[model samples]
Target: MNAERFEALAEAFGGDVARWPADEREAAAVLMAARADWARSVLGLAGEVDTALYAYAPPQASVGLADRIAAAGPRPGRGRWMGFLWPAGLGAGLAAACAAGIFVGAHLSAAAVSAEPLEPVTMAVSDQDFDFDLDGEV
Candidate 1:
């Protein structure tokens, strides 16, 4: 690798060439051996950077963070299990229900109409035919 790329890799992966990407490690080693003085300077800077980074202290999380998380409760699965009951699914379900209701209502209406007996198709039928003479007369 060129001096620039070797130096960049050393800076990125720290002073340890072994920790560098395996594909570039051999080339980086050859370049470093060729220019020992440059390699020493670059490695020294990388070591210093690593030391400073390792010494950093991160800020802790706010108080009651665990309690807040615990109180929130476990969330339900929002994966494929609930994919069927979507905006489109709701419409499909409603359409299916309406179709079923129409089928059942049609059957019920037909049954009701057929259940009651039809009146005889008589032209001269009169209420008096079934009435009794209140007086004792013919």
Candidate 2:
């Protein structure tokens, strides 16, 4: 690797060549051996950053936060077993329901087709069907 690429890798991998990607490690080692002084300077700067990162301590979570998270998690029972079969079982249930609905619909439609047709009735309206007074009296 060239000096620029070696420096980039050192920055990214935090000065530890062992932490670098396997394919890049051998090239980095060759470049480091060829340009020892410059490589050491780059590695030294990167190592300072790595040391600071390693020394960092993140703030602790509030008490019972873990317990609350655990409490909200899925409980052991029917749901756990059902989770394994969820996709397949749900698809099967929907298919069965559709099949049942189709069967019932077909049976009902056939019954309707075989049933007797209703006779038509006729009605006539004439003026004699109602009596009216012009004066607003019942």
Candidate 3:
């Protein structure tokens, strides 16, 4: 199809070529015809190509395979409780661990502080070598 005609068709059909405006029904019909012709040509070639592809046969199972599969019983699907149980249990465990850690830390700190003795505050000074010279020296 020519570029101008394709552009006109594109505009008439809005952005989606599959949809057409009622006002441009005639133009939409022409575009549809062109598209149908193109699709028919492409589909014919696709059918031939598909026919040329080689067919594949699945491998056959061993004689005892059916018996073994039947013996295994139905496949186990996921349990509903596990979905809620695991997360809830994990969260509870973590909260307990955090609380235990905080309690231990505070207890140890209190014990250490209480065990230590308070030191006495003292001041030392040397006596003056000379006697008091408190006489008035006018």
Candidate 4:
């Protein structure tokens, strides 16, 4: 009903009144009629801008250029996961190799430790003080 309410309705519906609901259509029509002066000013400004835009002509485009570009198709490349696959595979291989090395080292260490023999120590006395002298008259 008021200018502010009309402006809000206009902003929501834009210039197309057909998009508004049947119940609100009558109210919008009444508001539009009441705000004729404001509507005329806005329409005049839009018309001037439209005329200015129409005055400038775009440059002529080459024939068949758009078709040629469309026909060229997309560039050749890998997918998003393709870039990560190689690095992931490489990391897994390195981890497996490290695990195998650790296993082998542990086994070798265990074998070396088990194969070593422990030596036994003994205590004995030497008999070097007793000497026989039976070479006098024989």
Q: Which candidate leads in TM-score?
A: 2
Per-prediction TM-score to the true structure, in the order listed: 0.41, 0.50, 0.25, 0.31
Q: List the residue pairs that clash in candidate 2.
A: none
**Poorest stretch of ten by lDDT in candidate 3:** 11-20
Per-residue error (Å), model 4, residue 88? 25
- Number of residue pairs clashing in candidate 3, backbone atoms closer than 3 angstroms, sequence gap of 3 or more or interchain: 0
**Model 2 collision count:** 0
Q: Arrange candidates by lDDT, highest first: which order? A: 2, 1, 4, 3
Candidate order, TM-score descending: 2, 1, 4, 3
Q: Candidate 1: where are CA atoms >4 Å away?
A: 18-22, 34-37, 70-138
**What is the C-alpha lDDT profile of model 4 across 10-126, one tens digit per residue?**
555544556556677788677669777886564455456556667899977699888898865443473555455545785886688899999999999898789986557654546
Clashing pairs in 1: none
- Predicted candidate 1 versus true structure: per-residue lDDT over 1-138, tens digit per residue: 898898888779998777789999888878878999989899888988888887998988799997898865544673553455553576887788899999999999899788996666767665565545778554
Q: RMSD, model 3, all Cα superposed?
A: 24.9
Q: For each of the candidates, give the backbone clash count.
A: 0, 0, 0, 0
> Each model's C-alpha lDDT?
0.81, 0.84, 0.59, 0.66
TM-score of 3: 0.25
